[model samples]
Target: MIMTKPRIAIAGASGFIGIYAIEELSKNFRIRALCRNLPTTNSLNSDVQWFSCDLFNLKEAEIAFQDCDYILYLIHSMTKGSRLTQSTFDDLDLIIADNVRRSALKNNIKHIIYLGGIIPEINYGISRHLKSRNEVEIVLTCSGIPLTCIRAGIIIGSGGSSFQIVYRLVKTLKIMTTPKWTKSLSQPVDVNDVIQFIKLCVGNKEVYNKVIDIHGTELISYNELIIKIATLMKLKRTLITLPFFNLGLSKLWLYIITGIDYYTISPLIDSLKYDLKANHSLYFNNYIPNPISLNDSLQRAIENEEKNEIKPRRKTFEENKVRTVQRLNLPMGWDSIRLGKEYINWLPKVFFTIIRSKVNNNIVRFTFLKINLLTFEFSDDRSSTDRQLFYIKGGLLVIKKDYPPARFEFRISPHEQSAIAAIHDYYPSLPWPIYRIFQASFHKMVMYLFNKHLIKIQNKKV
Candidate 1:
């Protein structure tokens, strides 16, 4: 009798760590690579099966994780999924994490492994980026299934975003004007070492349900790291530090030099202000005594780039689809069911003359000037006290509806004192440009007002 290897399902399998992970983990585990789009390039292992999954959709996540014994969650929601995204990265990350948790629970998966950022010891004034990462970690931890969260610092490798930022800065500028944030320290880990750590943690009973922080042997300042990179590159550069320089100027400077977008760079720059060395140091020290050096990692990354072997992760967006997420103050003792009802009642009251909302036979209608603008049917089967789901059945603003239709979700945040209201997979009747300007803007304004209303309700109760 032959024993089959444990099937490992990898989300974000086309990314930097995912690609490397597939190449490495395929040797030991039966690999099931889950991604939004199937990669155009060949996989290192021909036996690795690919499953196309849009992780934002819970049904898709459940289907993708089926038959897999362990899950390697490598997803990050920094890039846009639709043509226009009216949501913050944190909200998107939370939703995706919740979906993964639910999917894993329903499937009865054995273990989940999440790779996240190194959270600062002093939690005060944490950047949105790190906070988002921490929130994701929290969501996964509550899954009841065993979880191992490896919080790593700036990952050093070719094609990796963090490394590229450094590489580009060193290569591009001869005379660089730096901010005080450059003095902040970080323990940078090599991509290969990160992969090794993941390999060690897989099927290891000791590491399950633990948060491990791993990093390189040395903790160096950003300025020192940059100087080292410059030395390795054999380039002569002058650096002038501005102690009072603001973050806005730093963002613009890096954006101009690296040519990376503000969305990607903003969080990274914000995170650089705090020193983020690992706290749980000896967890994996016994297994891999000698980690890769920063100089060597930089050298290898440079070589890979010179050889044209590295490819950055690519994002593919759908046309005309919309996803909007807003975090609102949750009225104390209120669940999603009541929150959804409150939203319905509040909408008409807020815009009394122009808008009218009513529910008949569990079907909700929002009308403008007595014309049905939107229709939603309550989904009792898909809803719970913690989460309420409403399907967008038909509306004047809807041009075409996909199978299962789009949805509106009012969900209670597990840990935070807030509720999340989101619209998913919505396609408008208006032209893309027109919808983006008018309908999108209007929806955001309404949500903003609703948030104010919630705060007022809480204040009155207090």
Candidate 2:
């Protein structure tokens, strides 16, 4: 008799850790990699199954998790997912986590293993990035499934954004201007060790429904880390500590030297103000007795880069695409479906009656002076109490051929007190400058007014 391995689905399988994970975990289980785009080559692992899915859509997430026994959720949206994103990373992370939670419950998965950040021992304040990670943890836990969340700090690996910032800073600057946040302590774990920790947690009954922390053997300050890296590279670097260097100046200095985007660097800098170390000491120590050292991990990262181990990332979005997400207060008696209907009904009262809206059967149209400006067809099959989706069917404001029509959606948040009105993959028919100047501004103004309307309703109920 032959034995079959348990099937596991990996979200964010195209990322730095995800790519390595697919190679290592495929030897033990049947791997199904969920990504936004399929890999051009099957060289990573031919046996690994790849499913292209946009996790924002619940139906897509459900289909991606089909027939999977365990889930490895490694998704993060530090970089914008669309060409134009009007939402914060925190909200973006929350929505994606909710989708993952819903999909996991629908599929009846056995376990979910999530990779998150090591929150500071002092839980009073944290960076938005870390807060977002914590929010994702909550959403996944609320699914009533067994979850093992592994928290780590400053992953040292090839192609990792955090490590690359450190590496670039040391290489580029001969004299570094240090801020007070550099004095904060951190335990930088190696990516290989993270992968090993994940491997041990899968199907492990003892670690189920627990939060575990993993870190490198050495605990060093960020200043010490910089000096150590300089020694390793055989470079003589002078560091000048500036007591009064504010967050703004620090961000600018790092951005200028490391060339990392503000979106990726901002929250990371915010996190450096707090000491980040592993609290659980012996939980998984038996499995990984000598979790890799800082010196050796740095050496490995350098070697991997020298050998060109990093692969090129495939482009995920087309040019001229736009995504706008607006969060509004949900009335006490309102669900997402109700909020969506109210929006359509309120359109006629907008812009001093210049805009008109009409709904016929499943189709909806918005017009100016009886000339159609936009059209949407309600998706009956996709509508639910928590979410309502409308397909951008046609109108003067849309292109003639949209392969899969762009979507306009209203979705309730995890806590149910708020809702989001979002437009995804929308490409305007107007010219870029014209759309940016007039159409975009008009859309935002309309949403702002709608938010005000909701607030008034809530006040009345009070």
Candidate 3:
């Protein structure tokens, strides 16, 4: 008999951890995402159902989880309490958990998975931050349903709070005066490992009704972590430990030097006051054996930042004009002269041109196999190949009659040594998901055609 995929509901789906968890878990299970605001993402999977919801509204929460078999909760408020009123973070956590349990009970949900902080080594010395996490776990357990609480220490991954703090401290100062918190031992786990655990524990019986403690193999102090990070980045640094430094003073100094909001840093530092290692290592039946090392995890974080640094942010506009551009070097730079400008331009050798304010209505026809298979034209086609450089601007980019509707911009710029092109397509008319499949190839083809035209022009061929 063929088995049906389970339905998993992800609460707080807009968080960084929730976002990644959805990507990982969606492969084998149907996913339902619940959040107050729609996530700002263009690469969302087609199979997932995203619902905008306010969890505090019991009716709304129950409706959202009506069909889900598993619930994965990954949300924690940093500011804590009621917005205008001063309520504690722990209190707010319990309130949210009660709402989730009520909804789960109404929907007959089977499992609840939560990612929480590991308990502090000292019995009663738990920081306010960790206490909130522990209290949340207790709230979930009160529902009388099977719960899997994967407790972990500072997660070392891209965009994680702990990693971001380390990044700011290392990037800002070469020489620093730190407090005793820097000496506390910590067992940082990789974000990838967290994802691995979530994926494995979906319907596994061994992890049910258990509070599992997870962490990496290495046990290092904050001072050591900073030193290793600096060395990996190839920087010189000096650290001075000052025992007299006050917690309030440390938070103020961090806010001033790093420009990180004090609200987020306060509770984090409080948690760092004690040793933050797991009570004991976890061994699940379906666990991903042998997580990656600390060095590898740090390297991954750096790589993620480097990629985000160069990605382009799309702009909002009245007309839905979407575009992707790239720069590349062709093997031959002198081909523009032979087939660069004017006179048929051979295969086609035109460089960049300034786009006119408005588009022109002109029709150009191309015949194929004794029949007019394709007929199209650009609004403006003033060709140029001066000094092995030219561009195509304000042209009719008709791909078959009725296409592009009307009003589109096409620009091409070619220099003595390089070329650039920006192709814009109407959002509603273009096949976005289909186009994404060939985005890389499209970039390569643009470059290929630019260079090939020069060869055809020099050979005196059409």
- What tens digits encode model 2's per-residue C-alpha lDDT throughout 100-204? 999999999999999999999888877888998988898899899999999988999988877877878888799988999888899998898889889888989
Q: Note the Cα lDDT for every prediction shown.
A: 0.88, 0.86, 0.64
Q: Estimate each model's TM-score.
A: 0.94, 0.94, 0.64
Candidate 3, superposed: residue stretches over 4 Å from native: 1-3, 41-44, 80-85, 284-286, 310-462
134 Cα displacement, candidate 1 (Å)? 1.2
Q: Evaluated with lDDT, which candidate comes out highest?
A: 1
Rank all candidate structures by their TM-score, best first, as comma-separated numbers. 1, 2, 3
1-462 per-residue lDDT for model 1 (tens digits): 988889999989988899899988998999999988897875656659988888888778889999989999988887788878899999999999999999999999999999999999998999999999989989988888899999998998888888888888888899888899999999999999999989888878899888888898789998888899999989988889999788888988887788766678888888899999899867768667899998899899988875884443344568888999999999898899889999999998889658999799779999999899999989898899999998998878987654364889898887778989999888899998899889999999999999999999999889
Model 1 Cα shift for residue 396 (angstroms)? 1.6
Give the better candidate number (1 or 3) by TM-score.
Answer: 1
For candidate 3, write residues 228-300 as lDDT tens digits: 8888778888999999997888888877766655667788888888887777555532375687799998888
CA RMSD of each candidate after superposition: 2.0, 2.2, 22.5
* Per-prediction backbone clash count: 0, 0, 14
Distance (Å) between predicted and true CA of 116, model 3?
0.6
